[model samples]
Structures are given as structure tokens and as C-alpha cells.
Target: MPINLLYSPECLEYREAGHPDSPERVATIADFLGQKKAGRFLLPGKCKEEDLFLVHSEEMVERVRENSLPYDPSTPNIRGIYDYALLSCGAAEEACRLAVGGETSFSLLRPPGHHAGSKRAGGFCYFNSMAVAVKKIPGEKRIAILDIDGHHGNGTEEIFREKEGIIYVSVHQFPAFPGTGSVSFANCYNFPVYPGSSSSTYMKKFMNALSVIAGFSPDLLGISAGFDTHRTDPLLDLPLKDSDYYLMGREISSLNLDTFIVLEGGYNVKTVGNACYCFIKGIGKEKHGQETGKRI
Candidate 1:
């Protein structure tokens, strides 16, 4: 089967002036993924309140609806932010749904969700969309989340750190923003890289992650794909290239997973789109481990 991708217009409402994260990232990716050659792509449906409640606490959901400040000190407040957040969460859920139903899918959602924990909403995120989808997937299955963002995926770790079935792995710049991936949580894997990391560094960490995940044998793989690791990205000091994402995508696809990729973090708009294009090409043109049943 071919890979599927999900996107929505609501993602555009998330505006951060003078910041790297912007709607241009979504527009570029969507336009590329929606191209005629890409077999499966979708404009995701709106996520319901119940779906949002799955990962976040009721209090947190209500708080976001009632009151949400700027997505952190970095970005300014935008109008109708709450509605956009709901759609982003919904789009992530749609991605998971397609992946679980035997199609690989990606959610190009922004105001990314990995940073938002069960109760808190900061770090340019208002909802824990990845967590919500992971928790709600059908069947008793183990899910592995590979977060390759420049900064730590603090919210995801906090939500699933104590759990056993979920394998949460992250490779990020240490002593950066929201530093929390260094300490090992139960079934949690982490790689805190030095300031300057390159393709070799990323590949090494990915291989290590593969070794760690081989034992876990996840039913589905959820990738928090971020471009903030790109060398040009001002967020961190990781020196990554566009081709790096192709290798990363091919490696993850080689795992033969029912993959659900969610847009996590990426600042520079130009590289983000190019990186995404390469990733999709890798997922489509590259094939490995042809045998396919339900994963895990």
C-alpha cells in the first residue's frame, strides 16, 4: 500500500512574527504532498472535543478554549487560535487513523503538539496531538514515537515517561529549551547531542534508536519530524541537510512500520518544505521489508 498524508488550512492561523515557524512551512509541504504523483493525501477532518480530551486533561482543554496566551514568550497571540488548535489535533488523529488502518500517513500540523503536555500548553503548542492519537489508536498495541526535533519533546516524555508499552525516543540539542530528554524514563530513549551535530550524528542516534526499538516491536511508529535541526535553523546548533531527511525517512520506512508522521518543529521555512519533499519521496520511491501485516 502507498503512504497517505493529512493537512488542513487551520494550521495557517498559527502565526509567529519574526519567527522561523510559520504558515509557509505548511503551504509548501501541502502543495508538494498534494501533487498528482503522491498517491494518498487528505485535508483532515475536524477533531472532536472527545478526541482532544483523550490526551489532554479536561481542565487543560477548557483552559485552552477559555484562555490561551501567546504560544510562549517567543510568539505573539493570533485570533481564533483555539479553533486552529482543535483542527491541528484533529489532523494528527486522522493521520494516526490512516496509519492504524494499514496506510502510512503524515500530518503536517503546526503550532506543533509534542511540546504541550497533559495540563500545560506552551512552547508554541496548545495541544498534545501526538499523545492524543497514540493513546486512542485501536487494539492493544505498542507505539514507538521518534522525536527528532532540535529541542527536547518535553510534553510527550512527561505524558508517557512512566509507561511501559510506549517507546518514546528523542534526539535533540541539550541545555536548550525545555531540557528534559536527558534523564531516562521508563521505556524512554534519549540522545542529548552537543551543540554541533551533523548527518553522521543523526544517523548514529537513529541506528541506536533502531536497536532499542527492535526489542519493543511497536505496532505503529509515530515520528515527530522536525526541521529545526537544520544547520540554517536559528533555534539550535544541529547541522542537518535536506538529504538527511531522505535518509531518515528511508531508515524509518525500512523498519516496515505503519507510520504516522506529525510535523513537530521546524523554523526555517525554505528548508522545511524541501526536507518534507525529500521525506515523501523516500517513503514513496523506497520500499523495504515488503511483508506487511499489522505491525507489532
Candidate 2:
């Protein structure tokens, strides 16, 4: 049960200099993974066009393929962006496949895609990679998407709101970007926290959400793992220390469901590296059938 760190090389091909969400994020993760070297490292291939079309409309899907231009003024669309996005989507799918097969894997992809939707791309995302991965898991039943990004998972929510096969849970800062997750709903577990909220508050809400996760008995679980909530993050005001991330990952691993973790937002380099290392520690502990020690 070695921990497999899954990623795609195409991530490096799409770059946006000075952007909060940049290729450097994946580079940082790759460097850390180099240190861990826990198990077989899996790299993703290009995603099938049909797979991309499953969630995104034909127009939206082709808009990214027209070779219109590389790197949109607001977003990065490089020559390989079409392929890079496909690879990220494939990475997520492979991560989910490994989890469903009872293998512990982490998707360290780029162009963090939680913000992408059926017909739009923003927040550095070109395709809803998490949603795409979830769709790959053949199921005609309810599925739960537990998003922990600093920003609300607006795209994920928009795609799954009226759909019955998905439950989108978001715990983000209040008055945050793309604010659509605060109001409580049967299908959406939107818990908006304020800046400076401590681990105690974060954990309470997370524990409550886990109960919902249990109720859903999700055939598969997807995490939009974003570490920007760390206090030191340039964009976020929350103060989540490094160890809190390990506790979060460990708790999620305890659910015993197929868990797919697609890398999302995290600006500050220091915390992203540390938090990813911490998460890997938790996932590695789970793979070894060992206790995650404590909530360090």
C-alpha cells in the first residue's frame, strides 16, 4: 500500500507568470514529491475528447481547442493548454481510479480546476477536472464532492446544483470570491468561515460536514484541496497552520471511501509545500494502516 503521487507533465507547459495560480505550484509539489518518493509515481496522459464533453458543452469544449490563442488575457491558454487541461483531467480520473481500487493516490496537477464549469473557465481553471473525474466513476447514484478551497467552489456548485447524483460541500471564507456557498441547502453543505478563524472553528464545521459525508455514503469522494487558507498566504486571511492540514487529510482518509484529491489553489510557496508534505504524511499513514499520531 505505498502512496502513489499522481501528476501530469503537461502542467509545466501551461504557465502564467506572476499569477497567484501558476505552474510553479506544481513544480513545488513535484520537488516535494521527489523527497517523499513513497511509491510508484503515475503521470497522466491526454484525456479523451468524449470525456471532456461529458461535463462541458460542445461549444465550451471546442473554444479551448480552436487554437484561438495561447494564454487568454485573464487566463493562461498555451499551445499545449488544450492538452495540459486534458492531462489534468486525466490525472484526476486516475487518482479516482486508484482510490476506488483501494489504492492511496494523490493528484498533483496544475491549472487548478475546481473553478472551471460546463461552459466557462476562470480562477486559472480551464476544465472542471474534479467533476470530470467524478463522472468517470460509473454510477447512477448520488456522489459527494467535498471542496476545501479558500474560495467557494462556484463552478462545482453550478454544475451539480440541480443534479441529483452529486452533493457539493464547500467550506470557505465568508464574503469570499465567487460567493455562492453560504446558504444552507439539502444538496449543498456551504459553510462560510470568516478570516482569522482558528483550527477549533474549522474543525467543528469540518466534523459536521463529515456527518453529511457519512449520510451520503458517497460511492466516491473528491477533495478540491486548496491550502491558501493558511494565514501566511498572500491572498487569504485565514490562519491555518501546517499541522492542521494533516489532521484534515487524516480525518478524510478515515471515511474509507474512494477519495480523489485534485490539487487546487494555494498561493504561498512555503505553506503549499509544507501542507502538501503534511497531507502526504496523512495519506501515507493511511496506506500503511497506521495511526496518524495526533492532531499535531
Candidate 3:
């Protein structure tokens, strides 16, 4: 099965001049993936305003809707941002829906979530797209969220901190923006790696973290896929190359569980598409010593 890629042209409407989370990130990746004929391309439908309430407060939802001014420091309240945020969440919701049906899907979303919480938007995010989607999926199955963004998914962590049947794992650059996730939790495990870390170093840490996920024996896997860990990203410092993403994808695929990925953070426009393409291809590859199921 081809990877179900959920995307929408409306996502490009949430543009802010000269911002790292510019609309071009999704536009560029969507075009690149299209040219590659990478997967089953799709346009996401709209999500209800009530869906937004699943992961965000009504006050926060109204704030993004009525106030066109920037609520977060770096996240611009660009024109049409409210509609675009809902659209992005819809994309993620669609991906999760596909995953629930034993198919793998990826949501090419933005203003990248993981930074936005229940009450406010931060780090270029307005809505917790994955959170909203995860909540909508009908299941009591154990879910594991592996966030490999360069920065800790502070908002995602906070939103689901006390929730049961879910384990949140994050590997991020230490002392970075938002500055949380230093300590581990009962359900959340965080690995704060040092800056300027090599790819091999990251791989070791990631592998170790994977053991934890494996032990959790989750019925489903959700990836907060962030390519900003690449060394060239303008936002943070991590020396991961494109090959690293492929290796990470391959490793994740070894688990052989139904999985869905949501776009998180990656600012290096030049390499972001390559990184995503590599990871998708890696996850789509066959895994040995295990009977394979349809992944994408």
C-alpha cells in the first residue's frame, strides 16, 4: 500500500513574511513528494470547530479566531490563520483515521504542532494537531508518541501529561526553547541530548529510547516527525544528516505496528524534502525476521 499522504493547498495560506515556518515548507515538500510519486496523495477535509476543543480550550480557539495579531512571540497570526490551523488539524485527523484502518499515513501539516498546548500557541504552532487527532481516534489501545523534534514537544507533553494508555517519548536538544522535559514522568520519558551531538550519538540515544517504546508494547505508534534535528536547520543545533532520518525510519518500521506520522518542526527548506522522502522510503522498505504488514 502506498503511504497515505494527507495534505491541502490551503495550508500554504498561513504564510508570514520571512518566518521560518513560512508556507513554502509544506508547498515545497508537497511538490517534491508529488514529483517523486511517493505515495497516495490526498487533500484533507475540514475539521469541526468542536474538534479543536478536544485539544484546546474554547478560549484559546476563539483567541486564534478573533485576534489576528501574533499571540506567540515567533508564531505570526497571519491572515486566515484560524482557518489554516483547523485545516492543518484536519490533515492530521485524516492521517490518524487512516492509521486506525491498518494503513500508514503522514500528515504534511503546519504551523507545525507539538509546541501549541491547550491554552496557547507558541513555537510557530496554533493548534495541537496531533493531540486533537489522537483524541478523536476511537480506541483504548496503548499508544506511543515518539517525538524526535530538535526541541522538546513542550505543549504536547503538557497536554497529555496525565493521560493514561499513552506514553510520550521525546529526544531533544537540552536547554532549548520552552525549556521543559528535563525530568521524566510516569508516562512520559524524555531524553535531553547535548547540543553539537553527532548522528551516531543521536542514534545510540534513540535506540535506547526505542527499547522503552518496545517495552511499552504499544498497540499503535504516532510519530511527531521533525526534521529540524538536521544540522542545517536555522532553529536549533543538531548534526543529523538526511541518512539519519532514513535509519530512524527503518528502525521504527522494525516494530511492525500500525503507525502514523505528523509533521512537527523542520526549517531547513533546502534539505527538508530530502529528509522526509528518505524517511518515507525507509519506512516503506521491507523488514526482515518478521512477517511484514502493509505500512503506508
Candidate 4:
């Protein structure tokens, strides 16, 4: 069973000069995946405004759609950003649909969106795609979201904080951008590692986070996958190697739940591709069957 990959070249249509969240982030992964033949690729469409309302307020949606917000370098209001964000969200929604149907899927698109909140956008993110995707899951299925990004998913935590039947866990660097997720509360669990933490230390925290998620006994799992923890990453100071991602993927695969992954943050173009490929290969080790979920 090949991993179902949700991506679109249109995600490369937006970019900001000198920003860490460049088009190369997704392009590198897509190129590498194609070269490796890692998975079956699928194109995704734009998500509806109603889907944005699943986790964002009407005001926020309109703000993004019409560029009504003030300028912010972290999250610039570029033209056509609303449509780009909607495309990313669409990929996430499609990935969720695949996961619930018992197929492993990964959304490899851009504008990494774990930082955008219900009412605001920041950290190079416009819409809370992961949050929106998780909300699309039907019924009372217990869901667990594990954010492995180097930066904490403050937006995701804010959206699902204390929400019933859903638990959000993050393993990230403290005192980082957005500066949240240092503590755990309600249904949101955070394990913060210090700058320059060894790979062993990071993995310890990651394992602890996984323990929390497993104890929740979730029916479905979502991974806010970010590769910036690599030592080569220009952003933060966590020293994770390439092989560690494979180990992390294997660990998550051991959980054996219906799982979906969404691209979040990974700036190092030189290494992000292989990191993503390794993680996908690790998760693809167990083949269930051909994915039958239709594109959204």
C-alpha cells in the first residue's frame, strides 16, 4: 500500500523573498518524493469557506479573503493568499478523509499552518489547516494530534483547547516564536525542549508526548509534521538528525491507528526533502490496502 500524498503545484505560486517559508519547502519534498517514487500522488482542490468556519471565525475568514488585516512580516497578506491557504486546507481535508477510511496519507503543501489561530494568522501561517482538517472528522471519534514541529502549534492548541474528544500534544522548543505551549492544560499537552537540546533529549520528550497520546486511546491520529528540528535548520537550536525522523515515524506507526499527516514547517531545502521521504518510508512499512478515499 503506497502512502497517499496530497499535493498541488499551485502551492508553489506564493512566496515571500528571504522568508524561511519559501516555495522550496514543499517543492523539495515533492521533487524528492517523485524521484523516490515514495507514494501515490493526488491533486487537491480549494476548501470551501464553510470549511474554514469549522475552526476559524467568520471575521478571520473574511480578513484573509479580503486582506483586511494590518501588515505583519511573519504573516504577510499577499495577493491570492486566501486561495493558496484554501488549497492547503483542502489537502489537509482530503488527507483526513483518507485517514478515517484507514489509509495512510500525507499532505505535502505549503504555507505551513500550525500557527494560525481561530482569529489570527502568524508565523508564516494563514489558516489553521490541521485544526480545520481534524474538525472535519465525523461523529465522536476520539482524535489525537501530535505536533512534531520545532515550534509549538499554538494555534492548533488554542483551537482545540479543552475541546471534548480531541487531544493536542506538541513537542517543541520553548522560548521560541509565538512563545506558547510551555505547559499542558485541559486537553492540550505540551513538552518543551530547550535550545541546543540533544537528539536524545528531544526524543525523550517526543516519546513522552506519544505516551500521552496513546493513553488517550484515540481512534484517529493526525501529525503536524515539521522538519525544522534538524540541526541544519536555520531557525531554532534543536539537534535532530535525519535518522531520528525515521525512528519517530516508526514509533508513530506502532500506534497503528488511522493516521494522516500535514506539512507544517521545514525551511532547510537541502535536507527537508530527505527528512520527509524517510518519515514517509518509515510509515509506509506497513501496507494496509489500496486507498479508496475520494479527493475532496
In order of appearance, the predictions have TM-scores of: 0.91, 0.91, 0.95, 0.96
Q: After superposition on all CA atoms, what RMSD does each candidate show versus the true structure?
A: 2.9, 3.0, 2.3, 3.8
lDDT of 4 by residue, 79-151 (tens): 9999999999999999999999988899998888999999999999999999889888778899999999999
Query: lDDT tens digits, residues 1-296, model 2?
Result: 66667876667775656778777777887787677774568877767889988889888888788755344565655566787888888888888888888776778887778778788887778889998888888757557888888888888888888678689888888877766677877588888888788878987887888888888898878888888877788887776887888888777877777677888888887668877888767766654564344432
The number of the candidate with the highest lDDT is 4
Off by over 4 Å in 3: 68-71, 287-296
Best by TM-score: 4
- Candidate 1, residues 136-164, lDDT tens digits: the string is 78778888998888888999988888786
Task: Name the lDDT value of residue 96 in candidate 3.
Answer: 86
Score each candidate by Cα lDDT: 0.78, 0.78, 0.86, 0.90
Clashing pairs in model 1, backbone N/Cα/C closer than 3 A: none
The alpha-carbon deviation from the true structure for residue 110 of candidate 3, after best TM-score superposition, in angstroms, is: 1.3
In every candidate, how many clashes are there? 0, 1, 1, 0
lDDT of predicted model 2 = 0.78
